[model samples]
Target: MGKHAKPSGKSAHHAPGSVVRARPLPVRSAVRLRRPIDIWHKPALSAVVALAIPDLTLWALGRLDLILYTSAGAMCALYAHGLPYAARARTLPWVVLGMVASLGIALTAASLITSTALLVVCASLVAAVHKVVCEATRIGPPGNIILTFIAASAFFVPQHAGQVPLHLALALGAGVLAWLVCMAPALIRPQGPERIVVARALEAAAGLLRTEAGTGGGEPAGVPHARHATAAAVNAAWHTLFLVPVHTAAKAAARVGLERLLVRAESALGDAIEASAEDAPRDARFAGAGAEADRLGGWARELRSGRPLPEVALSASQAEELAGVAAEEPGPRRPAPGQPRGVRAVLTRLAPGSPLLPIGARVAAGCALAGWASMAVGVGHPYWAVVTAASIYQANTTLSWQRALQRTLGNLLGLLLYTALLPLMHLGPPAMIALALACQLGAEAGITRNYWLGSVCVTPMALLLTEFGSPVPATTLIADRWIDTVVGAAVGLACCVLVTNRRAADRIEVALGRVAAAEAVACRLLAAGPATGADEARDIGWARERLTGCLVELREAVEVAAGEWWQRALPEERIAHAEQRGHRALAGLVRRLSAPALAA
Candidate 1:
């Protein structure tokens, strides 16, 4: 064995060749779950605005006869879009479209189907349709199902048969309003604050690099402190990327820049931690850099108060040199640490032949099975289809199954809460509108902290979205929700079991290529000539940063794949070894660039 055993997270355990954790889920310590306030704040603000808008509209229109709840629910969709799931914005329009289609089908079917039992079956079928479309499109969050729930619930609302057209128009009107609200304000470039945050994160990464290079002296206390500061900067950048449209040229460029910074910071941290070698001396150049990091970290905190970033001087040559290092190409490397290969297997099961298929067929099948079953059983509502679709969306199919269970359980309880609240609140338009706003905000606030809590509000919001213009029999509504939830949860889970992916190995290979390319760029910058090559150095730095991001992404993907299926990919140990080796090499590259030759 080599002298270095390889760096491992003290708590992480992995199966051989598998990226998934081989160990059981740990009981985390009572530390508060760390969510960035920045991410939380946007949803909070959006929630408030969403509620406020509907309230105003209801008052202005002077009509409980309107589909204010539809607008309210659609606005809730906007809130979900801002979250950091993969391809978030790309998924929003599909979710909105799903909502529209679900409403259309549910309303059309409701007019023809009279039996309470048949109505429930029809609602479930419609919900299944919504789930299928969303899964096909990789629509936003599982919350996409809520849109279906909203439309179906409206079916049970007691509207005079003749008023159907007016109700449909009102609902469509509300959804259109929501679409405009989402599309319009996104034009405003709130770049100043975001830029400052990104700059701060970059500076912190630079400072950390400098500290680790034998340049600084501080109590070991500073390491943890610096890590904390770096985390804040990273989280802030995540917030910025999550909110804007990534496809736009400017936003895309900024995202690329920010991602590069993130990659650099992650690589630098991994390198610093590894180089310390369990008790290595701190580098001399790191002293000033550590202090600078601390200073930048503090400045970042102040920036939260809307203050501009305080300009601090850097040795222009050193800064330029470091930028160059970041711009270099990625080199050949081994696999990353703690990746899962099982998810890739599960993905393959779904696609069979086409690995890049966007729609998760396995997931859709589960939803369909649940919906079909509920229909056969004559359940009151197809809450089951919604539940089934909502639960199994994790990175791994196994985790998705667990989430589906949790979501179903949570939704079941939430339905009870709605039952109790509906009668007490009296399903009038004003009261319904007020409740919608409150629930939307509450759901948004709780989503980041506790999914269960968010469901509490989400449940009522779903239920009330139906009563926008009419009331439903409370007993039938509540019963159907539970039946649908159970059926959907069961069906969704079953599909996950039946359909799995098989091409995790190929994906991992592709990911490795990206990492190697980025690393090569980084190595080139490290080997560059003097500071006179500043422009070239800057470009190299950006390239290195991009490589780092790609590696992180690949590592995460591999881990997910490994977790879902253990025997499908490269040996878990090999991947981990590769990642550690990569980390060491990258760190070496960073140190070389920061050396006297390059800095001078």
Candidate 2:
């Protein structure tokens, strides 16, 4: 929505008294293609390359039936791409392990259980794990869907206890290869991920300026979302910076350089917030802020160019603020007292009442229903149905509905593509294998545009991967997957509606209560006096972060709840009051800690 669009609840200029309504289900917006991510090719290229060696070697050896295991591990390369190499190195192995474990469970259950019904139940349970764990780990794109797809497919494959270890070993080998492939760029460009995140911050900041200038003809809506996005990008940059250890003087300097750019991005974001409250009419300050935004955009370009971080001019206060932030990080490896990390964090996520558990339950129910329905309807590939249903469970009912629509449309298109590619499959193994590889690559590349668009490649790719085994008739394959897709989408959407995430709505109350408590702490700290020692300053900064985080969580909780079909009305007045007070206290902390580096 651009210049002419009206302000919605999330818009920066919405009146406080205006009604806040749930977003009616998205249609045109759900399927619309947006701009590509900053380094969209990284995961796409990484996944396809990681898959190629395993696929070709298997094909050459007449063992392409094992692609499921290797593909599971190869897809590991898709994860941790956004994390700094230091973090990526530590995280990728765990991702690989999780993938393999999922496959193992599926295979063992498939081998032992004679009943097809029990097998579907086992597959659904695995899907539930895949959904919860992936979200808990915060692993990025392709996410649990890839894991579930592979494991569900494996559940249908003929397996014995004897074959499990060898298949697992193949997956482990491919996973090791995937790790190396993802990490290889570090030798040449150690800070590439860090730089990419900073560049994104700059671009987001620039968009704010364009809106301020009212030069681009759009609603000036999504301004709030952009502000939050820029903040997230900057936080990611800081996290990446923390991942870089500083044993050498040279490394320390590189980190400081990147930090300076991040500070500028934050400063631009601050200006956008101030600009939002003004009726400046393109006045001098707005003009100058616009210029500053342009400069940030240019520096962002420099960051992505594989060149050195461009020298940025900053005032003494800005430098001090940067130093203050650097001092506050406490290194990336350490977890805070309340924020449980690693396994503890995973358990915390699975804790009863956690929002993620509800979503996981939805996946399990939807997958079971979809798979059982497929068998009832006489479709042969119930696993395909299972995977589709598993993939459709999102954070809430509305989003799941959106994904369902996109998935159904994409699968239909993918079937048409498969028909057209019948001749290519007849070209034999290499051609068939290569075509599937292209689908993998295309899925990664286009999926970011829209899930359905990516599915155009994914659905066909899923079908083609089956061809690696004894060939199935194209007509039978197409018809089965098509039926599965429709059944899965319908069942998944139903589950989403029936399985309301009440916790998300409840979380809004929790967040607000936390905000009220945090605001009181911040207010007391502010009243105590200006931040003096490193300890006091750190406390203030931590308090600010917590308050800001709670506000974001509260806003998000409200949004998710409002979209849910059967949720109760939110306490909008309380939420509004909490955010307003929390923000005021946070501003005080920011001003005390680093007024010049950040803004008022």
Candidate 3:
């Protein structure tokens, strides 16, 4: 008996909590339409609704007090970015709490210390602390709010201690409005994009597994397209994960379960690869594998359509038989008679490949430049700094530098353009309100594809936001922007140099090694035949978790490897061949483990 199979008399059904319905992708078109309206529409709507109360309050407060509006608007910007909607829902309270505390501390500190340098130092330190806290606690969106509150409050610190309460109240008011804006989406149908993406990733992984097993090394048709699609799907999944907040204990638990499953699957795949690689195949093995691939392709399509899995269940004895085959060491051989072609195909498709976006020194450099520039310039607001910092991000450092340059140029032009328009538009509450919404939408629309386009909207938004309280000369606004931009671009680039990462290949190698080892172990166990005890399921599950983790790590490492200039220079052809072979082995192992015939 294999080490991991259940005993002969035990029930094969998993424990009640073990199963999780991997949700399929939400029904939505992949391609976007009407770029301007599409991009701006949601954020604009959100801004108009969310900003109304706060703007109105500023207006009611005479709109001539620069302190309130600039401070409040800075807070509003803090509330802007996140997991689009899900994080919006989960982040409000945390943001409010963080903001209030920061406002109070800034007010108190300002009262005690009157030096401008001290104020900047304190604010930057607070920014660093907020970032660290968010990372440490996984507090997410609220962390930004805390940082924003500190920056905004720093601008007015060294005020009488008695005024601290008013500053906090104003921040509280703005935060409340921001929360409302973020939450107003209940009025419309909510699409859970993040949830859908996660589900689709599982499906894609399954499809990949099936395809590798079925093809048996014949030139893969549409191989590049399939690989790209899978890569895109994975990217979408990760992005959504970052944005959304799983608020409920149940949801968090589910995430843990899912993470565990992925980990196991990766470990098992590695073991399978080592075992299979030892055995070379005959022509008949290739032909039979091809037939199975076609069947698994059908299953992949079915999964995409949200079809249920197979209804048949193996008895305890059959499961043991199945487990034994999976644990066998891999070498080229024909499948045991009557093994389902579909099952075999599905297993074959599970190979590793390139990542979606490669990360490297260039990205790190750009990020650091952006972060430092915003800090040093002592800008009109820290939000500008953050946006500039974020805008510099790219798949690599060179790209990051390119984007940073683009943003600086764009901001310079946009600021000048806004200056020209300043004389024509009245600096009244009504005009400011309208301009705010317009710039908010404009910024949101351009942000998706082009940083410069987004900067246009952002520039106007920052400038106009500053004008809410006092009438600053358009010339002054323009000058400040240019100075900040230059600082951000220079500092951001330097950061890229300071944080250079050259270990991408090593990470990829580690992932590959892990996968290979797990597969070998799994195959050896499978070769030993069926288990005698139910407790062996623990070993099986543990192996599966390790295998899954390795697969995920490999995928991530591959994604980041190419972003480094060095990874592209390696013997990619050899690596690619190994991946193909390993994928096939893993799929074959899965097919044997799950086959109904093995139950007999």
Q: What TM-score against the true fold does each predicted structure earn?
A: 0.68, 0.90, 0.58
* Candidate 1 local Cα displacement, residue 501, angstroms: 3.0
lDDT of 3: 0.48
Ranking by TM-score: 2, 1, 3
> What overall lDDT goes with each candidate model?
0.52, 0.77, 0.48
- lDDT per residue as tens, model 2, 1-600: 211122344443443323443345667877889877767788888888899999999988988888878888998998888988888999999989988998888888888988877788889989999899888877878789988988999898888999999999999999999999999999999989888887887887787666666534232557656655665665556556656666555766787788777656655655555545445344643667666777878888888889877887654555654566555434452212465656897888688888998999999998999999999999988999899999888877777878999999999998999899899889888997899889988888888888998999998788888877547888899999999999999988898887878787678778888889878989999899876555565566567556656666676676666667555556656776676566557556655654544331
Candidate No. with top TM-score: 2
User: Could you give candidate 3's per-residue lDDT for residues 1-600 as a string of tens digits?
Assistant: 011111122212333223322111111121122244222344455555666666666677764353442345334433534344655666556656666676677678778886554555555455444543443333432234335434544544337777777767777766676766666654452333333444455455445444545555544654433443444454444435434334555544443333222222232233224323436463433333333334334433443344443223443533463344334433211132232333353333221322211222233334344444555655554434543553454434445555676677678767866876675457556776777667766666765545566667778766776665455777766776677667656665566434544454555676778768766765665676644543354344334434444555565555554444222233344345545644554444444444332211
Q: How many clashes does each candidate structure show, in the order listed? A: 77, 5, 64
Q: Give the winner by lDDT: 1 or 2.
A: 2
Better model by lDDT: candidate 1 vs candidate 3: 1
Error of 1 at 85 (Å): 19
Error of 1 at 567 (Å): 4.7
